[model samples]
Target: MKAKIKATWVSVFLLIAIEQTIKIIIYNNFFDKRFAILPPILYFEPMFNRHYSWFNSMLKLNAGKGLHIAVVVILSILVIVFYRFLTKRIGSIKIVNIMFAFLFSGAMCSLIDKVFWDGSLDYIMLKGFFTFDLKDLYIDVFIGLMILLLFTKNEQLKQIDEKVLLKDFLDCLLNKKHY
Candidate 1:
């Protein structure tokens, strides 16, 4: 258990460092300079994103930084809370540790970007789609791995009762049980 926790923290910090370092390097050298990596498909153009998320930008919400930070905090809290349910239902497996580390690192990086970089330091742009940074990659990797895990662990996951799990999670959240 101790080893797992230590490994997870180390991985999270390493990922966070790598993501922030790349963002800083691109911010200093490639900010606003567009170069076609793959013509009409991909490009590198570093810039600060003022919008909280792509959804916000797509909808032109222009949500304030305070709201963005608050949302991130809430999301982070949810992740931590969800972990108890995850460990209880699936057991503390290595892949679970890896997924949570990626998620934690990504969320922490987003918070750092908001507080320090003024927003996400987006550099990789897909033609007409959107621009994103390494933090996004971390989250994407976590999501991909989770999907793969679900597919591979379908039988194991199906054995768990979701309603009871939800009730337990809520009980933990309401301080009725130790998560």
Candidate 2:
């Protein structure tokens, strides 16, 4: 358990570091610039978004900075609580743990943007329909993995009846036949 917790923290930190580094590079070098990367399908266009998942824009909330910070803090607390609950109930499954790390890291990236930049730097444009960043990718991947885990009916997953020791969990992850 200790080892798992350590590994999760390391993963989270590394992800956040990489995401922020990329964001900084894009902000400095590519702000207001667009480059065709596979023209018409994908492009590197930097954009700044202050809203939370387009919810504020879709609803035309026009939320103030204070309100945005307050809402994010409340939601972040709730997410942490939910994450803890899930971890307690599901033991230390590797995929689930990795998903949590990604989720947390993505949230942290956005939070850092809100605090420092007032918005996140989105550079990956898809079909000119939408723009996103690495943080968004992390969150999207986490959600997809979470849905897969929820729908999967593997016996090994069901056999995780109690909290697993870190060594056993790592061993199981390395031993693919167990799946």
Q: Highest lDDT: which candidate?
A: 1
Candidate 1 lDDT, 109-141, residue by residue in tens? 999988887778898889888988889989999
Best by TM-score: 1
**Per-residue C-alpha lDDT of model 2 across residues 41-143, encoded as one tens digit per residue:** 9998888887755567568888776777676677666566555555654556688779888888888887787888887778888984788889989899999
Model 1 scores a C-alpha lDDT of 0.85
Query: How many steric clashes between backbone atoms does each model show?
Result: 0, 1
User: TM-score of predicted model 2?
Assistant: 0.79
Candidates' lDDT values, in order?
A: 0.85, 0.76
Candidate 2 regions with alpha-carbon error over 4 angstroms: 154-179
Q: Which stretches of candidate 1 lie over 4 Å from their true place?
A: 88-90, 154-156
| TM-score for candidate 1, residues paired by index | 0.90
Which 10 residues in a row give candidate 1 its minimum summed lDDT? 84-93
